[model samples]
Target: MIVVGAGPVGLTAALLLARRGHDVQVLERRTLPSELPRAVHLDAEAQRVLVDAGVDFAALSSPGAGLRLLDADHRVLAEFPREPGAAGMFHQPDLEEQLRAALARAGGQLTTGVGVVAVRPVRGGAQVVTDRSGDPVLAADLVLGCDGAGSTVARAVRPRYRELARPDRWYVVDLLAPAPLPVWPGVHQVCDPVRAATFMPVVGLRYRAEFRVTDQPLDLPAELARFGAQDCTVVREAEYEYGARVARRWRTGRVLLCGDAAHLTPPFIGQGLGLGLRDAHQLAWRVDAVLAGAHDALLDGFGRERAAHARALVRLAAFTGWLMTAGGVRAARVRSGLARLLPSTLLAAGTPPLRPGPWVRRPRVGRGHGVGRLVPDVRVRGRRLDDLLGPGWALLVCSTEVPDLPELPGGARARVLHRGALPDLGPALRDRWVLVRPDRVVAAVGPRAQR
Candidate 1:
């Protein structure tokens, strides 16, 4: 197996694949890991992926308080409080280091300073051609493009692409502050049409600020004059394009696209990193299944599922962006009023669950309800459910008696819990069993599994 790019997504894909006994090789153009962190923070769902990969999130990330939507005057419009398992601000460099360590532990090979010039489909699998001075060529059973938005592999695959938002420049400013931070460690989305920006406290006293591009390059000192020039020192100033896009197809034969190569969501939701992590997690098991002699069609669902998920998140980010900065004065008033009137739960994460796809089993009793929703971490007898489930399907048998359970295509274990043990199981499990996927998403709910 060959994976392109060594970002979090690529390294993670290599780690998961190698863990399954696959000989995975990762190719990267860069000579070394990045010194600066790009991604600001990760939520509980994304944090779960790292934990499953053997990372200790509690030690790596600071405790986060979730996100807050503020008005022009900094008055709170809405806030989404982080749940107990939610992650705080995580330094990207630290995460990359952890990913690299995990890959090494899994025995995955990572070659830096070597770039893949092209990936061409051969008779059975694909051939990866690199741009090293020697111009080495390697054969692989499968190829994954974990590269960024301008992925060479994605272009080679020639999948139809759609742009959700026009690329707009945004200025980012990182700062190092002395002890006694000026602001609390929380994300503040400033919703001001004059100058929309995102403020986050990175790591300790380190802070990051992002603002939509302005006519004149923002003078960091002047823009942040309120902070008092002596309080913080500027680390770096950079500009990046912020937009949303997704590929129509994720896989073309043995060549596949994941991470930024597959979709790009606005930073409004901070799901950019999480989505990539999700792509890796979703594809790893299926790739294992296909290699295990499952039907080739089993790999057909990757594109559809990821596209749906990316589209939903893109829409949510765009909607939130509008509520934050799009509207004019009159619209802003209405938005503020609506924000105040709306229930706080609506602002919480995991609002609308991803629609079930080929990989998901539609619920028989709830009419597809809870089918694709991610299951919150629940502990039983002082052990986390995921820790107990390990990396396999979980059969939460709740029906009075096990009605001939269906064989899991990828193997599963039967775990029966007494009634009321997990109240979050809802009424569905009271009379039926629930099939949870390895990624901890509810797969199906019925008296008996269908297949």
Candidate 2:
């Protein structure tokens, strides 16, 4: 299989597919990822996905803490915790570089400076036209496009699918601050009627500022001046708008769309890359299954499942963007009133809880919940969740007394956690045995003796 685009989503897909024993190639148009910070927020769910993909989180630099919502004057509106198992912030390139390094270690090949111009479906495969050193054609059983919104794969297949376009244009200016701002180590959002600004700390003494400037092109110097900074260098600038759309068909014969090639949404909830990561994980497994001679239906399930998820994220992002960028006097009044009336708890409630255990359950042995479902990640004795299972079936026995069930087969691993002792277990599993799947959903809840 050949994957197009060497961005985070594409590189992750390549690594996973390669680990599943496929010969995968990742193509990138750029020589390397931008040094500038982009998409700094990484949520709890995304971190779990990275762990599941065998990424060494410890190898990368630690991310900044929590998320903060503020008003135009930087007055705190809401604050959310940023635990290791919860959401945090990191520079996009740093994370992407780590992913790329992992992909290289997993035997995935990356071809930089390769620009794919067209993709055409062929008999039982796909053909790609590209310009690396020169115009050349490459053939593969499947072509996975992870390119950004202006995807060459999307353009090539545009005539074969329906497209949705948004109405308003939004501009974003990314600036690098030489010194750290006198703020907490978290994300800050300043909402105003005419403009909005989001500040996220990427690393020590350096920060990323995302400005949502509408109506006119942003003057980087002028904008920086308004923020009390002098002579700041502009790193990146782009125009974007929120929209909800997906390829009518993910797989046309053998050519498929993944990541941004398949869908694009605003970063309101910071799910833009998160959803793409989900696509990589889900599609990698199904593609591997198909290659291993599993039912073709599994391959078809990719589009069916991901399309629904993509649409939901797009709508949610659009709604969130509307709330943050609301205009008019009435809108401003409503926004201010909301800021004054809404409790911090209510705002925090909007953020998902950190449920890590249910996420690691095996689907075949234990009941599988949908992706992003909350699950506990408690350890049994000295065995950590990362060690108990090896990408297969696992049983989590949380009981004071051993159950009467038969021993697990060679392919399955089991863990017995004494009641009221496992960390992060809370007071819920005091003396009950819970059966968990690899996907981390509780399959069965019963007395300890039931096993």
Per-model lDDT: 0.76, 0.64
RMSD per candidate (Å) reads 2.9, 5.5
Model 1 misplaced regions, further than 4 Å: 227-230, 333-335, 341-347, 365-368, 399-401, 404-407, 410-424, 448-451
lDDT by residue for model 2 (68-164), tens? 6676666676566555545556667778888888888888999988899889888767889998654599989888889977788766556243344
Residue 266, candidate 1: how far off, in angstroms? 0.6
Q: Model 1 over residues 1-64: C-alpha lDDT tens digits?
A: 9999999999888888888789999999999898777886777777777777777767777877
Q: What TM-score does each of the candidates earn?
A: 0.92, 0.78
RMSD in Å for model 1: 2.9
Q: List clashing residue pairs in candidate 1.
A: none
Q: Give candidate 1's total backbone clashes.
A: 0
Indicate the residue-level lDDT of 229 in model 1. 29
